[model samples]
Target: MQPAFTRERVGVHAADMVHGITAVTDAWQPGRTVDVSAAMQSVTARVTARTLFSTSIGDQDVTDIQHCLVVLFSGVYRRMTAPLGLWEKLPTPGNRRFRAAHDRLRGLIHRIVRTHRRTADAHDDLLTALAAAHGDGPGDSLSDRELCDQVMTLLVAGTEPTGHALAWAVHLIATHPEVEARLHAETDRVLAGRRLPELADLPRLEYTGRVFTEVLRLYPPGWMFTRTTTCETELAGRALPRGADVLYSPYALHRDPRLFAEPGIFDPDRWHPDRARSVPRGAFIPFGAGNRKCIGEHFGTVEALLALSTLCARWRLRPVPGAEVRPRPETTLGTGPLPMLAHPRAPG
Candidate 1:
């Protein structure tokens, strides 16, 4: 189900994504500080909405869904760190708000599902594909509730991490002029006055790709993940009990000095082909590893690359002076309100 749609149908949505991000960036006036972090979220959300559910960014339904998502995730950190887990069920103000948000979000998703079932056609979106899959077979098909779950999962998962990654990428590019210059050089040379990037241009946009790779390495949205041992095992000559939960943090591993030289610095050239292969195994798992890895990985990568290429080709985003930039690690690792000034780049 994932491969058939994510790999094959992504191109159909790529053009729309490019247009969406381009419009967002084009609206920015020179020398004005724009909250790129917010813009990135809006852009990714819109792209994922249109591609996954055929929902328009401007629609009130989309706005409500987005707002509900914000409220739903607002308490994630508290939920994660809560000792007894009683806070979640209690009708405190925060919990009440979360419950309300979750209900609204579910209602929106279910409404969209019903609309799709009633009005869907040969449209090339994930919802359409899932609906068709459910209608195709007997026992193997997903139930309506399952369909809603998948839709919600895709919208939430596909939007947030990609949005944060793009936000970090913009922040990195704005702060590092040398990296930014090289990125522009590659894009300008490859684009050659072309307005939008094609899939083929991805290979030649080496520097831009490396920039994104480094960005993910430094600021992976999925910073840490957990694994459980099904059977008792030994690691590094130490015994481990079955059902033991092991936590691995990619954020820490990526920045380990033992693994990467000068790990704290933002260096896109570290990903140059020759040097990139020298990294040790299990040192980098941004999206994740094994079968549970993110299904939207490729789609997100393509979307981010296109966004960086298309926007950086025309405008240079500079971080607003004295703006406090820091990671707001919650359910997902994110940057809070990255303010940046946009300047139009001279045509090459």
Candidate 2:
């Protein structure tokens, strides 16, 4: 999986990303207010589908998957944070909904995996790779059940966080005139005479990359994660027994003034090489750390940078006046409803 997401391999999906972004942006008429959050989610879902399965999912399937993911993630968060562990055992409406969503998503993945197994050679995506994988020993190769599990994890993790991060980047750029101006200038300059950005163009979009890095820092979709101790350990003069669950938040850690100057400010320049080095290694963990780090980190970043560059190249999205844009933290940090108006930009 890690090999599939390396920089060189992820570049193969750039065309899928460009297509999704174009479809979404094409529907935006001048001055028409659109829900940026929903739009970005739709784009990411389609892109993920094409990149992972080498097929286009119908609009209905996309909507169903999005709804099921929301229900499943929100339910899990509630269960994890509930004061009493017994609460989840009850047959409440929430639990019932969670079960239904879980069943539906699982069934979808199983069907897809079965279908891919039958025609694996026809596709050239992640699903095909998993289906054709071989190992030296018995049981080393993934079984159908394991394939379904991996597919589900990749589908859910790939779609939600990347979608939310793009939405947040759009919101931030819209709200900040200076940032918006700089972004437009860079996109216009780098993508000269081009309507869409390509993998070869990413290296020149330095500011756009920094903007994405800052977006992740400001609103990492996986805002909080928990880890359990494998053995007894001590931290900061406190002793922890084995199996103790410890939770850390990238959202809080990213905003620590001691680690970042003017932590509340949305300055992409903070990622400048010299300035970035001042922050300790472990202080920045938008994609987690160690062996548990996300496998799709590079893939997601490339998708985001391309999407941002393509968008800024042709249009400028401005937040609707008086529209209250607020963060909704669930399984992922999401913008609930970001209404914005798109204005076309003259070609550079």
lDDT of 1 by residue, 1-348 (tens): 575346566777788779768867877888888888778877887787888776422467766766776776677678888989987888799899988888888888888788787777745567878877845456777767999898888778877899899999999988888988888888889999886788778888988989999999999999988989999999779899999998888899899999999999999889898998999977889989888787778889989999999987888888777898988877778998888888888747
For candidate 1, list the clashing residue pairs, or say none.
none
Ten residues in sequence with the least summed lDDT for candidate 2: 55-64
Error of 2 at 38 (Å): 1.3
lDDT of 2 by residue, 26-113 (tens): 9899989889888888788778877777863466666677677767877877887788788888999999999999999888777778
Pairs of residues clashing in candidate 2: none
Question: Under the 3 Å rule for N, CA and C atoms, how many clashes does model 2 have?
Answer: 0
Worst 10 residues of 1 by lDDT: 54-63
Taken over the whole model, the C-alpha lDDT of each candidate is: 0.83, 0.86
Off-target runs (Cα >4 Å) in candidate 2 are: 56-64, 83-100, 134-136
